[model samples]
Target chain A: MLGRLNHIAIAVPDLAAASATYRNTLGTRPTAPQVLPEHGVTVVFIDVGNTKIELLEPLGADSPIAAFLAKNPSGGMHHVCYEVANIIAARDHLKSEGARILGDGEPKIGAHGKPVLFLHPKDFNGTLIELEQE
Target chain B: MLGRLNHIAIAVPDLAAASATYRNTLGTRPTAPQVLPEHGVTVVFIDVGNTKIELLEPLGADSPIAAFLAKNPSGGMHHVCYEVANIIAARDHLKSEGARILGDGEPKIGAHGKPVLFLHPKDFNGTLIELEQE
Candidate 1:
């Protein structure tokens, strides 16, 4: 069901500093920060050949990553996304396997404009997993 | 410079259960666990097309991930490994940029049998970064 590893999302307290670290220290060119009001994050994508590293900063008080930043002030790996051929089928299979889907168990338009659903971290070795339809 | 992401390492408290979750729930085949005593880890690799997800369980009392698991009982993203053309040069460049290299600041043989060095999380947005010579 899983295809390519889509991207690894890192929630950072300071987006510019994180982006600069990747750009200057790691020598990777990071895209300009783009604010996603719906997702409540300002994201910058760093292409690392096969996959991407997404630097996310909370956009507002109700931002999804605001709590994560509070818990991890310096920032941390937030989630890993995997591409899937058919998200509905994948979700169904995961449900049948006793895997817990996050939210209302419905796929939402993700940061990449793709249908995506998050799985419970406890059900996934404490890793927040995002399944994106490719 | 950073190349392809070598793998995303997730430290799991229960290796078998984590492997089963990836294999069954995610519908991805996981390689059999391989114990690396030198690294103090038992690892299973889940191929996600472009890169791999490395599931690491502590091998002994002094395992590097033991402390991480102690803090996160359920486990969590331990580190992100990125390939480098020349590790020594990468280390030198990172140092020039004031990035703190972990441990003795020398590249050591990583789980994949490649020379690798870990950068301080505080220097990289609180994300442990591994640079592997490829």
Candidate 2:
């Protein structure tokens, strides 16, 4: 179950350029860029009221974002992050319902020190969804 | 610029079936079914805390969702609706940044009497976005 919209991730070829475009268009600047070495990507956060727009860019060929961009080509939205009160309970509940968790047990620390886990796209009709707990 | 996340639309093949799946898995029932005749589709709303998950199914072949579902047959996330204080200002600002508006002038009343306007997916890197002012 989803609690709140933590952030919406958008994949772009260039993070700075994309961030600039969004800032100029939305009249808001991103907080800062953070590199997630585990995910092989960098993320920029733009606050949109109660929600956030995460801009992602692949670091290299082995990056997951790179693989996704290769398939999408033109670049597009990558995934949606839903905030949950309890990550373990939410993961277990989804798993019980035949949803596959991309992560095993406990969630890993993601940007902003939040615990996060990803759900396999197969279980979500080809949408990559992340569950984050505060 | 944005007030809150009104809803995140997910393009699905069947409204009833998708709604059932979500209800069973999420342990929550949808608010109700609402049809937007002009949009040529029916929408089911599943509240996710401060956000909403909108399951959309095309009503006919001419429906916009029909064409979208045709391309992404596996089905996936669609657009992200950002709530705004003034629809006209939002639309005008986005347009000034070279974003094309899919709708004409004044906002049209959607499902819940909320004024809404759509922005062309071209400006958003293939992601259709809706701006709603309550």
Candidate 3:
């Protein structure tokens, strides 16, 4: 089942400006941008006590967030990640309930090096959900 | 300064269906729907241990989320709320940094009955941000 709310991912058109907004405007220290070639994103993490705010910018032409940025040029909340105890069991449960799993229904190593799977946005009230094994 | 991530608000087109999805598919217990007429939203809270996932549905024609739902018909992440130690100080700091505050620039009672203010999404990478007095 879902446990902690892992992190909220925001797809930003400009990673530096977004990081500066959180650092200066929100008065929070955001981590330096780290590029994840596999994920096709340049990410910066802003620790907000209990959870993290991830600022993501497209890293390449085929970046996952590239389409999102094209639609919302200014950027927007991309997905919400939740910690799950047993991802395989969770995926099965979700499947039994008629919820669609994104990708090939397999958990992929995520940004945190943990097993994660994305659920179809349509099945989740148009909100993209990422379930990460805790 | 910002403290904990209070909650992530998701505006759903169907409140009951959204609540059921979280309760059944996600295997989390969600609170009964609470309608906030002033805020023009009917909300359901799903506790995710460290923080909460707020499911919001437009309450009336004047609902603030109505326009958002119109654009994203099925529903989507609406805003992210962070706890602030001193809202007045936070507001001043954000303003000084050239971040535009939403509304009349005054903190209003939020769904949790705490003073809250919304920041312009354009200034925050297209992500609407809500700051609540802790």
Q: What DockQ, between 0 and 1, does each candidate earn?
A: 0.89, 0.60, 0.91
Error of 3 at B49 (Å): 0.2
Q: Which regions of candidate 3 fall more than 4 Å away from where they truly are?
A: none
lDDT of each residue in B10-98, candidate 3, tens digit only = 99999999989998999999999998999999999999999999999999889999999999999999998999999999999999998
| Model 3 chain A poorest ten-residue lDDT run | A17-26
Listed for each candidate, the true contacts retained, as a fraction, are: 0.90, 0.57, 0.95
lDDT of 1 by residue, B11-79 (tens): 999999998888888889999999999889999998889999999999988999999999999999999
RMSD of 3: 0.9
lDDT of 1 at A111: 88
Task: Write model 2 residue lDDT over A1-134, tens digit each, in one string.
Answer: 67777888888877787778777876677867888877788989888777888888888568878877888765688999888888888878987888778846569887768899988876666678888996
What value does the lDDT take at residue B96 in candidate 3? 91
- Tens digits of lDDT, candidate 2, B1-134: 76677888888887786777778765667867788777788989887776788888888668878877888876788888888888889988987888788857568887667889888766666667788985
Worst 10 residues of 3 chain B by lDDT: B120-129
Pairs in clash, predicted candidate 1: none
Q: With candidate 2 superimposed using the best TM-score fit, by how many Å does residue B53's alpha carbon deviate from the native? A: 1.1
Instruction: State the iRMSD of every prediction, in order shown.
Output: 0.7, 2.0, 0.8
By DockQ thresholds, what CAPRI class is model 3? high
Judged by TM-score, which candidate is best?
1
Selected candidate, larger TM-score, 2 vs 3: 3
User: Where does model 1 exceed 4 Å of error?
Assistant: none
Report clash pairs, candidate 2.
none
> Worst ten-residue run, lDDT, model 1 chain B?
B18-27
